[model samples]
Target: MANHVSSEKRARQTEVRRLRNRANMSAMKTTVKKVLEAVQKKDFSNIDALLRDAQSVIAKTRQKGSIHKNNMARRISRLNAFVNKARNAQ
Candidate 1:
């Protein structure tokens, strides 16, 4: 639907970026889910590593502008809270 050459190029770039952002979001979600699962299972043996990995993914995504900085901070905060509570429970 882009009649102009520049418009067409812009559209192409937008499509590529959209796909990349979607993939990044999906990856972040998966990492968060993994951490939540660990918490739900009350399994702290490997949670530290998992939390670190999730934090890394979230930070990277935030740096890339895929997610907001505040959102990332909130997520990491909640994750750590869960991890700490779980660790202290036993």
Candidate 2:
């Protein structure tokens, strides 16, 4: 429990930030999943668009501080590699 008034306010702020981060993370995961699934299925028709969207989501999440810049770069790199491999295979 937070006894001090400032401490109580900080606790509330923490909770709000937690929830917001959770939602952003969930959304980012979903976008990444969609891109991966498309790659796995060899669906190249809209893969570029999907990849672009996923990259945007990751960038936005990083901008919001929900994820680190390096983490975002790693994910985008992996996703690009997957797409490239799939394209070559097809």
What TM-score does candidate 1 reach? 0.89
Question: How many backbone clashes does every candidate have?
Answer: 0, 0
Model number with the top TM-score: 2
Candidate 2, residue 87: the lDDT equals 91
Model 2: residues >4 Å from true position, as ranges? Answer: none
Instruction: Give each model a TM-score.
Output: 0.89, 0.95
lDDT of each residue in 1-90, candidate 2, tens digit only: 999999999999999999999999999999999999998888889988999999999999999999989999999999899889889888
Candidate 2 pairs with clashing backbones: none
* lDDT value, residue 82 of candidate 1: 81
The alpha-carbon lDDT assigned to residue 45 of candidate 2 equals 93
Q: Scored by Cα lDDT, where does model 1 land?
A: 0.92
